[model samples]
Target: MPHYFDTAHRQEIETLRQRWTARTEWPTWLLLIGVYAGWFGLVLASDRLGLWWSTVLLIPLVVLWLSVQHELLHGHPTRWLRLNKMLGYAPFAVWYPYTLYRDSHLQHHRDEDLTIPGRDPESRYLTAERWRGSSLWVRGLHWLNKTVIGRFLLGAPLALAALANEERLKMTAGDRHAWRMWLTHGALTLLMLTFIARYSVLPVWHYLLLISVPALSIAMIRSYYEHRPRAAPEQRSVLNEAAWPWRWLFLNLNFHLVHHDLPGLAWYDLPHAYQARREQWLARSGGFLVQGYGQLWRRNGIKAIDSPRHPFH
Candidate 1:
């Protein structure tokens, strides 16, 4: 990370950093606090409003909260690591811990290994040997997972299970750090659930099924095609330019290739930075671009966009 930027880009980034301040991040902190309070308030009133209606309304807020969690993990909105973790403590998303997420995501930013199947935790592609050894049913599921619809419906739950299983194995092998992370995450999750049970009109199971699942599914839309297998590693990340509502919900992550190129850049500044260097970014990514999520769904919602197995594998 010390050499994250070359000479020219380094100067531009240094100038940008000068303008960033703790005060600049107040809006983000305010939004996080407001959304969490609002979401919990809605749940508390679910009996009167109806559980289905409440869950439906909560989906977007949960997505926004998790997006902000991503920003916090990257050391935004505040310089203090302790304050950042405190901001990220709520387990509204439920399954993942901020500690584990921060570690894994930082590992994911190792540009040289960006989308390599076995190397990247966030990669959707299966390595060749694994694909070759899989039963037809397993292969079919992987193929379906490549499509927008399948990803929307199945990705989140499957990803949760996979991640949990990975952590289970690590803990079993005596990874004390992994053990501590999961233990702390479990305690916080139980604490959140106990509060929900105490006050929410909807049953805890109903809340988990109705709200958590759908929120995670919505996030899958952002992750579904963020990267692709490519001959050139740098070109693997995609630039998907979405308009207003979706862009705002994803916190301007549609300019994903730009984010990958400069992982330390603040979320709000992404759009401006991307616009200023639009042509350069497009060129750097070898033209891996899209208009929006709509384009992806239209093109690959049913059919697989790429094979489940990595092409090189």
Candidate 2:
């Protein structure tokens, strides 16, 4: 693989290193407060509004909350790790524990392992042996999952089931971290559900079906084509100069290569860093660029990007 940056660019990058302060980040705190207000406001108002209307308002907020949690996992908007974890402590997404997410995401920063199936926790590809051994129905589902349409529709539920099964195996094998994470997640989930049942107009089941499921679906649109298997690790991740709405919603995460390169960089500063060396970064990624998610939908809306099989396996 070719070099990603020259001497001049390296100096440019050096100047952008984050400056840590003793104070909290007010912008991030305000965002966190505003997001929670909107989410709960919608929940409380669900009784007066239409069911679909509530879902429409709540889904994006839920997705944004998860995005905020992703930033928190990176120890952003704050210098203290405990405080960051506290802010993201709630299990409103109702899927994974924050601790588990933090651990897995940090591990995913190993750029060399990006999109290597089992090696990368975030990878969506399947092993060749697993694909060949799958039943025809299972194979068909995998094919459908590769597309944007099927991904959001079926991806969340299937992924949740797979995660649960994986957690079960880990617990069975006496993984204490897995056990603690799941226990914490379960307790938080129960508390959240109880609150919803007692105070919110939306029932717990309805909240899960409406807010949680669709939030996962919205997230799938971003992750669907974020990475692909390649010999050169730099080329694995994509750079999507998507619209402002997406950039805001995903917190500038569309610049996957930038985040992978600078895992500790604050989310708000990604665009500046990317723009500073737009040409070089594009070259670094071997031109793995997408105009937007719309382009991805148009190209892979009907056909799959690659077969489910991980050729190496």
Q: Model 2 residue 158 lDDT?
A: 80
lDDT of each: 0.83, 0.83
TM-score of each: 0.93, 0.92
Residue ranges of candidate 1 with Cα displaced over 4 Å: 1-12, 20-23
What candidate 2 gets wrong by more than 4 Å, as runs, is 1-7, 14-24
Provide the lowest-lDDT 10-residue window in model 2.
17-26
The sequence of per-residue lDDT tens digits that candidate 1 reaches over residues 1-313 is: 2364567766766666667453477657777778878877887887788867887788888898889888888888887888999888888888789888888888888767767777887888888899889999989888888899999988987898899789889999999999888888889889888887887776788767878888989999998988888878778888988878988888888898878877777787788778877888899889999999999899999988888887774
User: Mind giving the per-residue lDDT tens digits that candidate 2 earns over 11-96?
Assistant: 66556653332134555777789888887787778778867788788888888888999989887777689998988988778887
Tell me the RMSD of model 1 versus the true structure: 2.1
- The number of residue pairs in model 2 that clash at the backbone is 0
- Clashing residue pairs in candidate 1 are none
Candidate 2, residue 6: Cα displacement in angstroms equals 4.3
Model 1 alpha-carbon miss at residue 81, Å? 2.1
